[model samples]
Every structure is written in C-alpha cells, then in structure tokens.
Target: MTIQSDRARDALLDAAEELFARNGIDAVSNRRIVEHAGAANHSAIAYHFGGREGLLRALVERHHDEMARRRRELTEQLGETPNIHELVTTRLRPLIELLDSLPKPSWRAQFMSQISAVPSAVEVAKEVIGDADLPDDLRFINGAVDGIPEGVLRGRAYLLGSMVVGVCADQEAKMNEDANKGSWEQVGRFLIDAAAGMLGAPVTDPDGAVRYPSVPLL
Candidate 1:
C-alpha cells in the first residue's frame, strides 16, 4: 500500500475505534467513520478493509504481534514449572502493558469489551488470533493446573477474559474522568492475582461435591 493509503487506513481504524468505544459498535455507520477519518472517499473502509468484519479483524491483528512478543518474553522468564500466578501474569500483563503504552484517552480496551459482546465480531477477532492452535505457554499452563473440573476450568477461562476486558475498560474510562483512579500496573497486578485465585480455586458441583478435571488456561 502507498503511504497515503496507509495513512487513510490508520485514520479510519482510529476513528472507528473511538466511535465504537464511545457509541455502540452497531450504532456507528460506515459513512460516519469515513467522515470522522476525514477521508475524501466515502468507501475508504470497504476499499481498505473490505467491510466492518474485515475492519474489526484488522483492529485485532494490529496489536497481535506486539502482544504475542510481550507474552513470549514473560513466558521465557518462567521456571521449568511456573506456578499459577506466574502463568496468569504471562497471559495477561501484555494487555495491560499495551494499554499503558497507548496515548492517553485510548479506546482499545473499551473497543475490545464492545466487540466481546458481538458474536460475529468475536469470531472475527478469533479468526485474527488463530484460535485453532494454542500457544505453548498456554498449553503448558492448562496442563499444569490440576484438580479442577474441565467444565469449571473452561468456564473460569471465559470469565477471566471477560473480567480482564471489563475491568480494564472500566479503569480506562475512570482514568479519563480522573487520572488518580490507579495505574495500569496496579490493574495488571490485581488482575493477575484475581485470575490466579479464580483458576486455582477448587471446583465443586452444585451439590458441593468437589471435582477434579483439568481445565485450559487460556
């Protein structure tokens, strides 16, 4: 792509992310995105990213390499057998760091939270993430955790993602209101502790019968 087209594409992504974060994703129209981006062509989004689905995929893919690299660095620091806390940090800290690195008033976290609720958008993000293959650190973390029912583990994993995104979005919004809400490092630490606790918690059936089945650490 030429430099000019690349600039337009980035501008569109920026405008879309802000609009989607402030307003509901479904509430923002393509025309508005083009207007916000100040692109001369009304079809810039379609021309650059195909459509809304492609745009969302591009948004997710935008940070994939950096996040993956950060995770990889954390994973490399792990001992042969890392504990749940270390595993949780490896899985989540990159996101917090990414948020920290962004300019003030970032919408990436809120955009992710919004997309998490849209099934098609979530699928698009998963496609960008290539969910078919689990990362080695993730696979190791999943295998290391024992004595939890597979079902419970899976449920907690899903909840963990929701919690992280929700909390980060909330915190980001709060920071916009008052910068004293807290630092991203604090958020990261709290999330790591909370995730470690949730994943390591004992699993019990409705009747309170303890169950032991392995769960993935996604």
Candidate 2:
C-alpha cells in the first residue's frame, strides 16, 4: 500500500479502537468510525479491512506484533534455558510494557478486555494467537509448563489471561480518571506472583472433581 493508504488504514484502526473501547463494539457504527477517522469515504473500513470483524482482527494483529517482538527479545536474552518464573514473566511483561509505553491514558487494555468477552472476538483472538509470530519463545514456555495436564493447563491459561485483562483494564480506567493508586511495575509483580502460584497449584480433586449444590426447581 502507498503511504497515504497506510495512513488512512491506521486512522481507521485508531478510531475504531477508541470508539469500541469507550462505547462498545455494538454501540459504535461504521459511519462513526469514518467520521472519527476523517476519511472521505464511508466505505473506507470496507476498503481497508473488509468489515468490522476484519478491522478488529487487524487491530489485534497490530498489537500482537508488538507484544511478540518484545517476547522475542526477552527470549534471546534468556538464551537456551530459562526457569518457569522467567518464562511466565516473558508471557506478561511485554503486555505490561506496552501499557506503560503508551502516552496519555489509553483504552486499549479495556478494548482488548471487551473483545475477549465476546464469543466471535474470542475466535478472532484465538486465530491470532494460534498464528503468533513469537514461535521459539512460546514453544519453550509451553514445554516448561508441560507438567500440568492439558485440560487443567488450558483452564489455568484462561484464568491467567482473564486476570491480566481485568487488572490492566482497571488500571487503565483509573489512570484515565486520575485515580490510579499503584505503579505499573508493582501491579506487574503482584500479577506475576499470582499467576505463578495459580499455574503451579496442585490438583486437590482429581476424581470427579468437586460438585456444587444443584438448584431447586421453582
């Protein structure tokens, strides 16, 4: 694409991210995005990204690329073998670093948090992560965590991922409100410690698991 085209695409992505993050994906319209982007054409989103879903995927890819780049660098610094803590840090630090790097308060963390809650958007995210560019580092980390059973590990992964998003969103919202109480590094450390514990926690109910009380009929 030409320089002008690239700029237009970026404008659309920026506008869409902000609107979606603030108002919600369903609340925002294509027309609003075009207006916010200052694009002359109403179909610019379509022209550039095919549609809203495509635009969301593009947004995710753009952010994931930066996160993946940071992971690659950390992995390189760790050389061949890194401990489980270090591996988990590699998983999270990049995202926290990105949040720290952004100028002014941003809605990006909340945007992602919202996207993660949506079923369709979750599929988009899965597709993006499945094709993540940080190959060796992720593979190495996966191997390090291989002790956990696959099903249990997946549940843990979901919990960790959700926790990260929820915490970051709260921080971002507080920052926007000028009510942030803690440092990013402090939060990162706490989350890393929590994630490490959750990942390493032993199974207590291996057989049939613990069942909850059944609901009574009205």
Candidate 3:
C-alpha cells in the first residue's frame, strides 16, 4: 500500500475503534466510520478492510505482536515453576503496559471490552491471536493449581477474561476524565493479585458436581 493508503487505513481503524467504543459495534455504521475517517469514498471500510468484521479483525491484530513479545519476555523471566501470582502477572501485565504506553484517553481497551461480548468479533480475535483452544500458558496454569476441577478452571478462565476487560475499560474511561485516577502499574498489580486469588481459590466441590443454569456467561 502507498503512504496515503496506509494513512487512510489507520484513520479508519482509529475511527472505528473510537466509534465502537463510544456507541457499540452493532450501532456504528460503515458510512459513519468513513465520515469519521474523513475519507472521500463511502466504501472506504470495504475497500480497506472488506467489511466491519474484517475491520474488527484488523483492529485486534494491530497491537498483537507487541503484546505477544512483552508476554514472551515476561514468561522467559519466570523460573522453572512460577507461582500463581507470577503466572497471572505474566498473563496480564503486558496488556496493562500496552495500555499505559498509549496516549491518554485511548479507546483500545474499551474497544476490546466491547468486542469481548460479541461472539463473532471474539472469534476474529482468537483467529488472529490463536487462543481459541486451550493455550499452553493456560494449560500450565491449570496444572499448577492443585485440586481445581477442570470445569471450574474453565469457568474461571472465562471470568478472568471478563474481569480484565471490564476493569481495563473502566480504567480507560476514567483516564478520559482524570488522567491521575490511578496509575496503570497500580491497576496492573491489583488485577494480577485479584486474578491470582480468583484462580487459586479453593473449590468446594472437587467432583465438579455443582451445576448451575447455563446462561450466556461472558
């Protein structure tokens, strides 16, 4: 792509992210995105990204490489057998650091949080990031946690994703109002500690007999 084309593509991504975060993925229209991007062509989204889904995939993939690299560095620093806290930190700190590195009032976190509830968008992200199945890090964490039933661990994993997205969204929103609401590092520590506790919490039913109504949980 030419320099002008790259700029237009980035503009579209930025406009889509902010609009999706502010309104919603379903509420935002292609025309609005094009207008927000200041593109002359109404079909700029289609021309650049194929469609909304493709645009969503592009947005998710934008920062994936940096986030993956950060995670890899953190993982390498861990000892042979890291504890739950260390594992949780390794899993989450990279994302928090990424957000921290962004300019104030960034929509990336809020955009991701909104996308997390959309099954199709989540699938797109999973496709790009390759975490649809049991990732090796998650499997390692599961093994490290003693006596936790597989079902419960899976459930906790779902909750962990929800919690991280929700909290990060809230934090990002607050940064818009007061940039000093709290440091990203502080938020990262809190999330890491909370995740460790939640994941390491004892399960009362080891047999996995506890049943609850299956609703769309996360």
TM-score of 3: 0.90
CA lDDT for candidate 2: 0.74
Candidate 1 vs 2: which has more lDDT: 1
Order the candidates by TM-score, highest first. 3, 1, 2
Model 1 alpha-carbon miss at residue 211, Å:
16
After superposition, candidate 2 runs with Cα above 4 Å error: 79-81, 131-147, 207-218
Runs off by more than 4 Å, candidate 1: 133-138, 206-218
lDDT of 1 by residue, 1-218 (tens): 99988898999999999999989688899999999999989988899999888888788787878988988899899899888899889889889999999988888888888886667776777677765434444456676788765556555666777788889989988887785658999989999999999888876662443332212112
List model 2 lDDT by residue over 110-134, tens digit each. Answer: 7887885566776777676663333
Instruction: Please give each candidate's TM-score.
Output: 0.89, 0.83, 0.90
Clashing pairs in 1: 148-213
List model 3 lDDT by residue over 39-140, tens digit each.
999989889999888898898888888877887899899998889899888889989989999886689889988886577876777777775434466577
Question: Who wins the TM-score comparison?
Answer: 3
Pairs with steric clashes in candidate 2: none
